[model samples]
Target: SRPWRRRLWDAVQAAVLDPTNGLPKELRAQIAGVAMAVMRECAAEQPDLEFIAEMNDHFAAALWR
Candidate 1:
């Protein structure tokens, strides 16, 4: 499970790495949708506050930019 989570993170990272793909309007919306769902689920678990904060910040920065 951890490994798959890591893989998913990796894929997300890769997907956003390229300015071309990352800058596309449609792709940005899709990424925001997926990240929002993930962040909500992650926060629902009442995880370590620091980790949750970090994850939220990460996703927010990506989606907002």
Candidate 2:
């Protein structure tokens, strides 16, 4: 279960970061939501506030770019 969740997280990150994929804005927003949800879930389990903030910052920057 943990391995699968990690894989899902990795895949979401890759999709969000791929610049040439030409994903629609709506779809990208949905993907970003998923990524945030995953991060929140992981943070709940581990309580890594700094890592969570870093991930949120990175995600926001990617969204703007």
Strongest candidate by TM-score:
2
Candidate 2 residue lDDT tens string, 1-65: 34454454667767876776688867877776767676566647565656655666776698699
Question: Which pairs of residues collide in candidate 2?
Answer: none
Misplaced by over 4 Å in model 2 are 1-4, 46-65
**Root-mean-square deviation per candidate:** 9.3, 8.8
Residue 41 CA displacement from its true place in model 1, Å: 0.5
Candidate 2 positional error at 16, Å: 2.3
Candidate 1 lDDT over residue span 6-36, tens digit each: 4454566557655677377777667656655
TM-score of predicted structure 2: 0.47
